[model samples]
Target: MTKPPPTTRPVITPSRVVAGVCLVLPFVAMLWVGSYARVTPALLGIPFFYWYQMAWVIVSAGLTSTAYLLVRREERARKGDGR
Candidate 1:
């Protein structure tokens, strides 16, 4: 019987490290910023303490998207997408 061919999965690369950092840093920043702003006053009409957390909703989305894109690119490259 013929043996199955060996898989050619791409090894972990620098992009993976970047993606991991992108995923983790924003979350850590969000936590620290939220805590630091906890006792601050309002800005314009919005509360200072509230804005950081609220802004993180958008920032988190951006960070997540960046991470996803990086991971997808890495996967595609691994699959020999000619990157």
Candidate 2:
């Protein structure tokens, strides 16, 4: 009996790498507490620590959206579905 062909693995292209970075950056920034563990740099009376996290909420959304788009585009290209 002939052996079955091996399953194809997903290619790790540059666009995928950028998507991964986008997804990971927010977690890295938030987890690195020491970076924003301050009170001086206030934004409209909000402390740096608080404001920084709040700002990341918006940034994270954009980054996540970008990552999603990149991955989707890559997948479409792989499937030869240029849309």
Candidate 3:
């Protein structure tokens, strides 16, 4: 009988690490509010703390999208479809 092809396990790559960082940065930023809790370096008169959180809204979206793309690309590559 012919042997079946080996199944490959998913492994962490640089892209995956970047994806992880992208996914985690927003959470860390928000959770550590004390770092941005200030009035200086305000943007257009908005307080630093408030503006920082709001900025993360857009940043988070980008980061999420980036992470998603990175993982998806890696998955595709693993599936032998990256070319």
Q: Lowest-lDDT window of 10 residues in candidate 3?
A: 74-83
* Displacement of the residue 30 alpha carbon in candidate 2, Å: 0.5
Candidate 2, residues 1-83: lDDT per residue as tens digits?
Answer: 99998887777899999999999999999999999999978999999999999999999999999999999988888779632
Query: What's the distance in Å from true for residue 6, model 1?
Result: 5.5
Clashes of each: 0, 0, 0
Model 2 ranges with Cα > 4 A deviation: 1-5, 81-83
By lDDT, is 1 or 3 better?
3
lDDT ranking, best first: 2, 3, 1
Q: TM-score of every model?
A: 0.70, 0.88, 0.78
Clashes counted in candidate 3 amount to 0
Q: Pick the lDDT winner.
A: 2
How far in Å is the alpha carbon of 82 misplaced in model 1? 9.6
Candidate 2: worst-modelled 10 consecutive residues by lDDT: 74-83
Between candidates 2 and 3, name the one with more favorable lDDT: 2
TM-score head-to-head 1 vs 3, winner: 3
TM-score of 3: 0.78
Best-performing candidate as measured by TM-score: 2
lDDT of 1 by residue, 32-54 (tens): 85475654577667877778677
Q: How close is candidate 1 to the true structure, as a TM-score?
A: 0.70
